[model samples]
Target: MGISKHSIETLKQTLDILDVIGSVVELKKSGSNYVACCPFHDEKTPSFVVSPVKGFYHCYGCGVGGDAIKFLMEYEKLSFVESVEKIAAIMNFTLEYETSYEKKPDFALLDEVMRFYQKNLLNHKPSLDYLASRCVANSSIEKFALGYCGASFETIKFLNAKGLNKTEALEYGVIGKDSVWEYARFSDRIIFPIHSPSGKVVGFGGRTMSGANAKYINSPQSKIFNKSKLLYGYYIAKDKIYKQKKIIVCEGYLDVIMLHQAGFDYAVATLGTALTKDHLPLLAKGEPKVILSYDGDKAGINAAFKAAKILAASGKDGGVVIFANGMDPADMVANKQINELSDMFANPVPFVDFILQHIAKNYDLNNPLQKEKALAESTQFLHTLSPVLQEEYKPTLAHLLSLPIHLIGSKRLPQHNPLTFTTPTQEIAESVLIKTLLEKPEWIDFALEYIDISLFVYKRAEFTKLVANEHQDSALIALMINERIRPINDLPSLKEHLRLFITQAYTQILSQIPHYTGMNLQEKSILMKEIKTKILQLKKGELLPYVSSSTF
Candidate 1:
């Protein structure tokens, strides 16, 4: 059994494909459809088109076309069911799953294991005392579902007797087996159960209270758990993140928990992995600013620097909070330095400024060679910023380097152009047709008569919708007018564009006629004759096509 077809169809019906695609890509209405640079590949000029009427998208450059679900599957790397669940979350739709086929281990079982760990922590006095020494409050412990496991084999026996599958338990990293013995993997350690965004416990993270080889160990990546994608405490911190429009990302689970307890509920942690590209979409939800809270140590500083670059490249606004030597968020809270931590969060250095400071810290300004090297490195990094931001920070960088602002270039350094165009003139013609109907909805019907609907490479759905509604959609018209770089201003402009589009369409079709290697001599001759006649009429200053409908 699989996900119900009805659910997928219902989801497709409720979702606007344009909205989903627009959330990731900066889409502008060029004509009947929305256009943006294809996210599937890097290109400056837009070849991606989203059609709301058709409820799908097509990228002429990369040739990736799909409905909403397909787009999610490719963009987010989610499986079919995962994509459905993601969309369901957006639409607030409840999905019902089939029962006949089972996939992966049961999450319900994982919940029971969590309960066992929690109970075990209660009985373990030394672990509780250790937590207390760290200034972990009882309320915070309960709120975060903190737990522990005993070091004895009896714990495994108890779990086995409770009908836990040995394979499943091992898969979740809850238990381990060796040459002739079965043992609990995380014994004598405090357990932090990792919950999914929906609040179901998917895995556990264990920190050693005693001397262990690794100070921290996490559950292996299972079907339900992905360390790279899961942000610690995200399920709990999401609401606070939305309310504040910011997220505090720290280095460890204890940092996140302590920050929350100290009244900064927006903090979360990475699960033993540095921030990655996969984490961006999760962080970008609700469009919140990010603050990286790391230690002052070299590893921490390097991690913070790397994360800041990722944030900048993704166009996210954020900063950094480097905790002082030998101090982390947990240590700060444990020492009752809540006020100082609050101040650090409040006054985080903006990402660009933080990067600038980080770069300058390595080189002495007194040495000419080092100063020049620092300035060169800073200039190259600053070039990655948006044109507006690059301009905004130029003066600050100049003052820091003790150099004139003009020494740093105002424009972005030229880079190689990787994008190539196909039939540039024809694409422009297709764009004009779409852009005209969008700016002046009233002309949709007139354009429909003279221009074949199939001639539109973008905004075909918008064109179809306008025609169906009898050339009326104030919302669509407003969107087009607001989004256009320069809109059609008057009736004469619209008429002129329509004439140009018709001429270009005939010319493009005529050019492509010979490429129809599949056509016989009679078919080729007939198509060429019709196209030649249309071109002659267009050259004669005919404003409209003689043909009533599209023949191609």
Candidate 2:
């Protein structure tokens, strides 16, 4: 009735769990699995392990383990279907529902129109001259698939000859309803094809060439084209962005094209809008360092300020570079100032520093009321960062406002509850083993088949309640909250631990047989021989079949 099970399974099979997790948290290669500081909890050391082969991630510190869909549901606070919808969007996979689904986009029509525009650009002299004037190299134009659409009649006549449908054209905003071939929507402009991450052209960004007109336009908002979600030139720059581990965010398409031409191929631009929260998913991909390159003008600075807050609050690593004196990346590259541009991009103010500076600049710190206002704003901004980052930047904020470091940080800095973990390692291991069985009740049947509850010497009360599926015991509450105690994460490790417990149980049984009161000597001898044979088989690394019974 919701999402088909087959489609969900297909998504799980095709989805790359690393790429999905890597989008939200920065993962570094360590040995066989990728590791990072657990994003779910505050920790100084990295204990989150992502196993690509197993297609899941486990955080040893916080004990959160799941595949890609489970991760999205937890971190994003989405329902099962919503999480599936998000993964489908990221992977460019279509989700088929049990009843019906949304219609797919008409990419063939877009491709045909894209080719038509490219052909028109080749025959237009002014468009070519405009590119030459902007220092847009021939190679750059070809690489980005930059093209030109012809004048009013010229655009209308072509679609008419191709017999394109009127309704489909109107639905995609390809043309308007008019006497002239439905008013050719992309009339008389230079077009930059906008593509999805997988390099499928989804929409277009059109620029007017007239000296009197310097405005840019986009395809009307449709199911296929969303300006907030799509980044210009991202389809081309993605591979380079992944390789360099960096991405430059600029103001215009020309800035991206010029930056790429100047050897900074890992550059992309917002689609005529400031960066939005929707863009975070794209920025998180590859965990790239986001460099905010904008002009030093008031508008640009304000835009960068908003962008700085978003990036800093979201835990993005990178800086901001202001291109002062009205010169943008396009101008700098055209003027052959590659060295200066390179130096500027190489050194940008860190996000938190930039946010602090921007917040402080708004109020005159010399005034008492303004100084108090600045302190409040700074503290609020500091709360956006992790506790580690907040502490790291406290001194900087304090110095900026000419105040003591004690007055800095949030009104009440977060403090971890004091914990005493004096329990022995054997006790912890037993508690964790019981916790594992408690979390998955179905596994308790298998656990009982192999190991007896009497082995739960350290956590017998907790184990008893766990088997009964009750949670009233105070000891069970402490057991779950103890971060020091963690169950084995993966399947293979769980099997090995269970085998060790089985051997210990057999060993315990062998010693207890001679003390039996109800058994005759002959019966004791038979039980003793059977126990010894089982112990020897276990020593040979043989696995006994676990039976389903109630005789734990």
Candidate 3:
């Protein structure tokens, strides 16, 4: 059964927009509305305005204005259904729906699987013996959710009995569907459950028990699982990551587990996929810095370099952490001096240093031709950085390559401005009008009388309908309802431009209305001419001048 629409609405009614937003953004009272720095963009001034009267928000700086659901969708980067489910849970609302679909696998089954693995570590002889030989501690086993599956397939049978069919369990990569039921996935491996940010078991990754062909196997994509967007151990480490404002990104599950065991709780790793844009934002939530602790192998170094380029492009600080003697983090934790590992983290090297150090190991700068090649490659990489960062690195690269400082500086780079993209006229108008109404509702009646509703396009039609309702609070309330505003998303630039034009038109219409009341027929005609002239001038990029005494 799925949630009902009525229940969803009821949940929304219980949760206030101001309270939800206040949880994330700092808000201060300003007359009847509240103001804060817009969370969706980088800004120094307080441009985000919230109005309890209208039950909506608008950001003058970025032109993002909408109701609570819209806010949740944007703020959390969630799908519409996901946002509704989250808000429904927060409001303690029970959904009512009936469906003929088969019952979905319960989360308790995953819990039981984890419990079985834990019990196996303590009671199962083969599992216990395997951990002892590897020098893996009982405490570490428990911490990493390390467990063993028996020689038999009891775990599979147990899950099957709990409403999970062979196909569904196999979909989650828990068991195989072959007639033998060959313990589908983890035959005898250490299991690691991947959890969503909200703490639901979405998938798993398992390490082989023996020195086998495949080292690791992860769950395939399921309804709730996506490999690119997920990082192993993020749910548990998010708070620490947020507090420390730094995250240690490693290659494998054991590497992350060992780091946590070593008191570096802010470590995370990709789930069988390369670091992506989805991964970048989640890391950005904690801090704008990432340390790539990849293996010392050529593949690992190449992955780290690629990740560094992406992080740098997104305006994040990132670098590679090469192991001292071609060791992975897990091996280092188990075999190397713990103090040596600790010292490396404590005295973290800059990304540039790591890049130069690695290059030095491979290139012979004593040869003039080799030196020139190194300079060109390193200079190209440095050039990709922002102007400010490029300037900072110029002197360092010059000294390292033993080249004239101006050599690198001679290459011109393109400057990036985020605001170069303009918004559509419709969106600009809608946002502008919404902001104006929230600020001064008295102009609503004037706007309704003078502005031609037909002038507005699709989204503008909804706004016009709300205005024509002839009820003050009711019209404002309509703005709080969430619906897909099509064509707006398709043409975002036009939306932004529309908001500006609409806001200016609303202001002009409101101001001109009061002056027209005292004018005779001749005076009214002159006023109309003046208004037309002003509109034409405005279209030509001229500012509106103040009107004093009427010439007529």
Candidate 4:
């Protein structure tokens, strides 16, 4: 429901910001206001300031300044409406709506429908037996409010008896239609009720226990239900999440329940889709860390990579945990692998390391072509991060690839010709001479004697590393060089190729330099002469003298 402006004003007026915020953060009086260490970011000293008179907070350390609603929304990952409702509930105040909401299915009706499913589970022995077979305790079932939907029109009948017509049932996804007629949306399956952040049952997810082609089905999007915005078990797990300051994001409803039953009460899962940006706000609220516990399948692996990228780019503190031996969180718990599961939760892989390893696995680092492709792909992802994060990681990735730090951002770095306009084939050709030299490490001195390392354009760091005989892997070093075969016996052919590649690099560098209109005529003449001299040297087939020191 949409709240009125008057209700919001009254809400702020009636409640004290210090009181509400103080519940979660310990605050000491600092003059007219109170202060605490900022919850939004890491800091040693108190920087988060709160003003009871203003009814707002400002974290000078993180530059996050907002009102009570904004603070609750960010701190708890609650939606605007959810935040207001929470505050209203705390203040024992009823909210007033300015605009009338449409007469849609209310939570009372949803609650009644949930009761029908729960009753069905009680009578259905087979579903209960199935839960037992999966090691779900009776207490766990009751705590999760688990239910079953039989393969019949019982849900439709139950709702119809309570004055909810078939149209409303269809709208709520309680029923779906085929070519012939309509049937219950979920049947012959264990049902899991998905709740709103405020603890109201808004939708359902049903998993087939029999031989059904579709393993699971969820309620379609509706006024109350959006799978993207909701997390399974989140409402129930919110208290534990707040207490533990951590949340385990898994891939299935059972994974969440099993984890919770195993005493990890802060576990939650995405409704039916892979974790998306819509879920981040909710996940960010309860803690600084979120553990993505995905299955060890190909799909799960890909999803983990994507989830890692999203979390890293958004600057969220989290890690990805993929189960080994094809086991999921539920499987691990079922098999009594508590130690392994606990260890993963206790020490999740850091996000940067996880993504780098994932990208590296996609290519054969032994193969020059694949290694180059992998590094290019990895560097592109790194560029999406903030500058501070990007710089912090550059040296680490460079050291991993045995390349120069400059090469990590070679495409963006001004010293090297911007590779933005170069075709992949052109870039590969440019890297061939370097790759061949890396394979014949002794040949690096001869090549360096002729061409300056800075003018090598691509893979300058890897080239320099090879020349210096740094600790390296042959296969990874090969990938940084072009994967093309080298004819070492044909010195003339090799020299011709090297000459052409170096010429092209200089030509590109010259073309890319901007003409400075601010330069005086004498300075412009000197610049033009310098550029022409290099072109003339290239044209005369004479190797230009080393122009600058090594870039990497």
Candidate 5:
């Protein structure tokens, strides 16, 4: 079920617009308003202005102007419902109506827990020593929001004070309780807080400080956090990834931290799960290329293959980076071979190449039978791409398979050419008249007196609505607001095409409405038949006969 409109409005009212934005961006006081660097676009000077009084923000640079809800939608990249729920958490307002929808908790408790962990990291000596041994620098720890969860029930008490009950705490997987006894789930471990893209602390990944069993422990799935959707270091590296147009997908938290420390800013890691579609758009922002840097193991290769299928299906350019001599990025960085790691990132192989390599390793490529099988498998992979992309890559696949390129047929492509129009000559003439009306609405009434309404095929509703309302001035705006029509920005030539189409449709419709003051019924019927035949000929691309059968 969807969130009720009443609940959405209530959330809008309870959550202060300024407070929500201020958390992510460092908004400064400017008269009664606030201003910050626009997160949506890059600029040296601040063009993003927020007016708390008006409850709206306008970016002069990008020309994006909207309310708080719109701001959250654009900035966090969330849907309407997600934005409402996020705001609801900030205001401590309960969204009461129970439904099958997952119940997300207030982030206040998680925020408190993160702060506690951060403080513990600063104060604890053993945690500091452990990090030092692992070559995790002090600066890196603070930058990545790393901390330590003490091995005791003190974390439980800290969370309890923030109004989180035992059940609620356990639900987050931060603590465990058995018969009124509670203990920390993560003990003597270097903590990495898994945050949502919006920067809400969702869960934790703890590496054992004692070098004990289970090298890593992660927070169980909670309402707000899905392991598949959450990427480690995304909160920090998102902007860099956008700017660089590339992202390095490493295997572990330490791998991410090490890479970041080594001056590679655009890197993130999965939360102990294989790559999923949830990671695609997040990584694909600004058209960034992805490089999967999974460890060199049988399990890692298997994971990479799975990731390749997803990336290929998503229609994004990505590649796999196999470490030399079975070394992970973290090991390479720690062992002072950071340059080698950087080289691997610099010259990444395409995901398709990696998949083919994997196939060649298992199959006997010299055997004609094996080569044929390999080509068949690769062809199926290539066929999954869009027609445009398929055409571009077909030659490359032919080369890889050692086959003549022309042998691959291209019949699967769609036939629509968005660049061209197929309207008839009379339709173009009518369109020109409509354009004149759009440019000057006063002419609409003058044309309506002489023109009939039946000549237009499409845009009948829009024309009729405007004529009935005597709102010729708003004809363009009416069409723009219609859901049936695609957004002007989405179509490349929409502006030019819309002007032409609307003008013609308007003229044709206006020319169709009969002027009945002088015309007899029989004469009007003959004129109507001629106009209908003209429309049919125009639509079907058929030539009108020189004379009618009656005339012959």
Candidate 6:
């Protein structure tokens, strides 16, 4: 609910800045106001100054300048509404809500509902058996307040007995439909209670024991519970997160529980959603290093990549660990691989490295054109980071693309030019290759056997038009009229470029062999051997006959 504007104005007009900031910061008299070390950052020289007259504070060191309300938002990590409410409460002011949030999400009713779910688990043998099978100890279950809510119309009866109604149940997502009493939102599932940062139970996460339902489902968004803003098991992990100055984010509730049970208690999971920018605020608190642990699957890898980009861009310290094979944290813990798991956590792929690798993986390093695209993508992502980070990761990006550092973002890569954009050897080779194809159409069929369409990125459409026998496009016209259109006239020089493209394509295919996790050992071994033999032949200046498809 939003606070009334008049109430906010009153607090801004009457509240004393000195009293508000002085309560948190150790301020001393400075001529007419106060001065202290900046609380937002580390500074020993006391560059932070507070002005009672202007009712604001500014730190010369970090340049974080703000008023009392802004100070609370930064220092305490509170939202604007939270900051206003906090200071208003301190001044004994009754802040009016813009919308009547008269009936808040029935906190007491939620507590009662959780207690009933816990009671239901103790009696449900199937739920208990499932827990036992997963190696979940009774103590761990009780400690986490794990529970069961079966489909028996029992939850409705119990809530009715407690004098609660459908409005509260539907408001918090206990029942599927709000208009009438119906089946529970969660049935035949193991319930994991999600808590507020203050350790109050606010919502539920259900893990389906039956394979018929989605693997997991979280409580619907409510007045107080936003899954994107809440992390599972955070209430338990917060202390360790602060102590160790690290947090391990995972994909599921069992992953967090297993990690905690395995003695790695600084682990939490997103509530059935990928980590988002909304999560950054809570993650910013305690200044902890963020580690993301995910399953070894396509979705998991994509999630980890997105999270790494966000964390890296936001300047959060962290790394990523994508479990190999089909393994996950829960599987590893159950398999008694604690040492391996700990080692993985201790030395995860750093955020910068993970991001660079993920982007590079999408393009073939052997293809000169793909390499340029890869470099451009890597540079774009790098620009989002701090300048120091951008500079630091540039060499790393260069190494990933097998290029010299000077070539990356050296100059803006031109769009319509084929031969004029000098620099970046890949572009030079591409322009040479395309000029060869355009001027000497006789060599087109010969080169078609060696090069993929992706080998000509800067002038790919022009190259495609040339291959298709349509020579009237403006881009091709521009290439033809350009002064640098001196195409290779000899077969030997053209053969040299074709050999490089062929060898790189083979090498790229070879490099991705191990990543074909779905392939059998024998099949992968045969494919690797064939690709290696072809690459070896190409390196020895031997030409192989093959039809190159449009795709690489």
Tens-digit lDDT track for model 2 on 13-107? 99988768877676665544667778888996676777676576776666677778888998999998999988887777888888876636466
Q: Best candidate per TM-score, number?
A: 2
Q: What does the lDDT come to for candidate 2? A: 0.80
lDDT of 4 at 260: 91
Superior by lDDT: candidate 2 or candidate 4:
2
Better-scoring candidate (TM-score), 2 or 3: 2
Model 6, residue 348: C-alpha shift (Å): 0.8
Which residue window of length 10 is worst by lDDT in model 2?
A: 543-552
Ten contiguous residues with the weakest lDDT in model 6: 411-420
lDDT of 4 by residue, 1-552 (tens): 588889888887888675467656766555556667789998756667776654567765566767777888999999999999877765546788866653233566667778888999999998898888878888889998999888767776777688866676777888887898778888888899988776888889998978799888899999668898789998899988888888899999889999998998899999779887767657655444788898888999899889899888766777888887888888778889899889988888878878988888888888888889988988898887766777888887886676777778823422211112344644566466655665566676677766766665556675666666762433233343211323354567667666676667656655644554565768656665676687688678866654531120
Worst 10 residues of 5 by lDDT: 543-552
Tens digits of lDDT, candidate 6, 196-266: 76677789998887885588888899866888878999889999999999999999888899899999999
In order, candidate lDDTs are 0.77, 0.80, 0.65, 0.74, 0.70, 0.79
The local lDDT score (0 to 100) that residue 308 gets in candidate 6 is 94
- Count residue pairs with overlapping backbones in model 2: 0
- lDDT for each residue of candidate 5 in 1-552, tens digit (9 for 90 to 100): 777777777776666667667656655445556666788898655667766755667665676766677778888899987887777765556664546565655576777788899999998898888778768887999898888888676786787677766676678888877796778989778789998876778889998877879999899888767888679999899889888888998889988998898888788999999988766546644568888998878888889888987887665687898775678887777788877877788888787667756755666777889877877777677676667766776676666667688865443644432113566665444444454454456656755643445545554554665566543223333332222223323222333443344345434543754764566778767766765665565455433322321231
lDDT of 3: 0.65
- Flag regions of model 6 displaced more than 4 Å: 1-105, 178-181, 410-552
Model 1, span 83-138: residue lDDT tens: 88777765446665676553333576788888888998899898899889888999
lDDT of 4 at 57: 76
By lDDT rank, best first, the candidates go 2, 6, 1, 4, 5, 3
